[model samples]
Target: MENEVNTAGRPGSFRFIHAADLHIDSPLRGLSRYAGAPVERLRNATRRALENLVDLALAERVQFVLLAGDLYDRDWPDFHTGLFFREQMVRLGRADIAVFIVQGNHDAQGTITRELPLPAHVKVFSSRSAETVHLAALGVAIHGRSFPQREVPEDFVPQYPDALPGQFNIGMLHTSLTGAAGHDTYAPTDIATLKTRGYDYWALGHVHARAVECESPRVVFPGNLQGRHANETGPKGCELVTQSGGQMEARFVPLDVVRWHQLTVALDGVESLAQATQTISVALAEAVVGAGDRLHALRVHLTGRTPLHTTEAQQPGTLEAAVHAAAQDVAGAELWIEQVHLQLASPIDRARLAQGDDAVAELLRLVDELAADPAALVAWSSKACGDVLHKLPAEAKAETDWSDLQALRELLADAEATLLARLGGAV
Candidate 1:
């Protein structure tokens, strides 16, 4: 295959790809449990992402590819996962592009147990200690270390060898870099330690968000090759780095076949259940456009004051069905609503309504009282809905979190809204 890229600017210009957290064949977010989920496609998204990475290496004619960590999700249930990875490596091998990899926590627990032979062009770093691989032909030195086991509480940087003179040194590590939100502390080290480590560029992994921690020496986390769940939203890909005359430049490219998104659709001016669904449809279309052409797995949170909150409460699963229909309505748009979170509010002012003296008003006042006192709310719920609660096990209480004050308050509000809907327009 013939591919062309501009090597404009310097004499010894060369390109390389820096990627991490492939998590190949990862079972994403347990989508299989959901009836309407695109389970097969999402489960295969990680493998597709890896293929895209290989294709990019061939297209860009990159000298080498760096996979910082987590190449596999867990120990293979079968040999297909390993076979798939080996095929991709062979593809890169045929293109004369070498690959460098280090085992992250997942890999340490997973693929290490079911080892498979990769192409000669690929090198996986040793787990016992840090090792440096030298490519004298390109004057490049890559230093890395794989995790011996799943947990690495200590620093791996201090054990790494110093940079060799007259070479473009790159440090590959699977670390949280001190600590990061939504990530466990593994191979933790601060930026200060990295800055003094003497590497020209640092490629990090483990954290599933794209970040450029430093610019002067170019410290980066390419993010996961593909998003595994709704929590991991937005474009997921790798860093394309080009070395021109001794200066390095990097850019991110979107490679994920399926993208995950969390969208908030306001229902303030919505008139009916149909209109509410239409508004969410418009929002989904716009979100998909902004995300580019790919399958969008969305978790939409409906919020704001609307009359449809009552309608949605009365007709359970209607909103979900409406959203599903909307996602399919837009031709050529790949959309799937992963979930519909309802945070909708009634249009009426409950405080003002409660001031009146009527059955509805008395009900509102009672709701307000229960909401203010958690203990009273629980006791009331037990008295009101004891038949249903008693039929189920005590463990079921955790599911709805009846003990949480805020959860009970929300439940009371939703119940109040449903009652108001049946009473006639909140007047």
Candidate 2:
């Protein structure tokens, strides 16, 4: 058994797995099509992670499993996705582990018309309104409501039924909870409002980063079962919750088969590319220690002021190749560089350029201004791309969103760096 607290005199004492944002069969985004990339392995990552969750539950022999939401992606691409989920459900059913699920924005009712019959062990909450499922033998009551549509703009807290008297209450909610960065505000509610519901634990979803919002009532987000992109870095998994003696204990158990990491390596005073490569190898070695045997999809950010800045910026592809070589050399575990970023500072002194009010200084000032203002950067990109973007193929246009402020900023930064390198005599 994973853990069990003695509750000899207590009425409610049980353990359950609380997990959310499974995103089963969801494709990993932003994968490179370059040679030697682990595209196939990444494609099947979600399924592997889901299997791990089931294995953990069986090994621990939990009474029940609480899947807060997002069991499926936005919609099923085909019936295979549904079949895979059903197969897993059958596995859990055979073990007598009941699964309580609530539909989040991604898997809201009507999102996917294709459906396969799930095992009897799974109890999906209603999308029309909040409802409760009482586990009579365990003295547990689970309250939840699924998203009727893709977006839930109103608060549904008041609709949840009151907790059953003398029962362990759990609220399975797929909410953004007031607000969370990089996630749409769905089924929004505040921590204060959740606490008012009198539930012993709130299993939250929608936020892909695991967070423990409260200890008393134990409001928690177990994060996504797997990290689909670089932005969703670090350990991703579910929460193993144990309730005994009126106290709730939640522990994060990482179930992701592959981990995404964003590592930063400082290159201060580095004079040559060889030294820089050595530095990256050392960082990769350290990262490998933490990754254990899991596959690592790393996005390395090379930062700091260095004399090799011009070379790195000018030949980013070459530098990336070197980093990839180093990763291959030192990686004790499977590691792949999703991308390598050069955020190196220019060796040229801005103050010295400003002292001479020349064209170079004015150009630098203009670039700085555009970089600072996202709107200006977007306008500049629109003008620069003008006729060329329109002439491009429909597929190319669809792939690139020039209107995105962040994308425009990155493009402008790269252009500025290239221009600065030429003017500063680095070329």
Q: Please give each candidate's TM-score.
A: 0.88, 0.89
85, model 1: CA deviation in Å?
0.9
Clashes of 2: 0
lDDT of 2 by residue, 113-170 (tens): 7888778889999999999999989889899999898979999998899978888888
**lDDT score of residue 155 within candidate 2:** 93
True-vs-predicted CA distance for residue 125, candidate 2, Å: 1.4
Q: Candidate 1 residues 336-360, lDDT tens each? A: 8888877888777777888899888
lDDT of 2 at 306: 80
lDDT values for all models: 0.84, 0.83
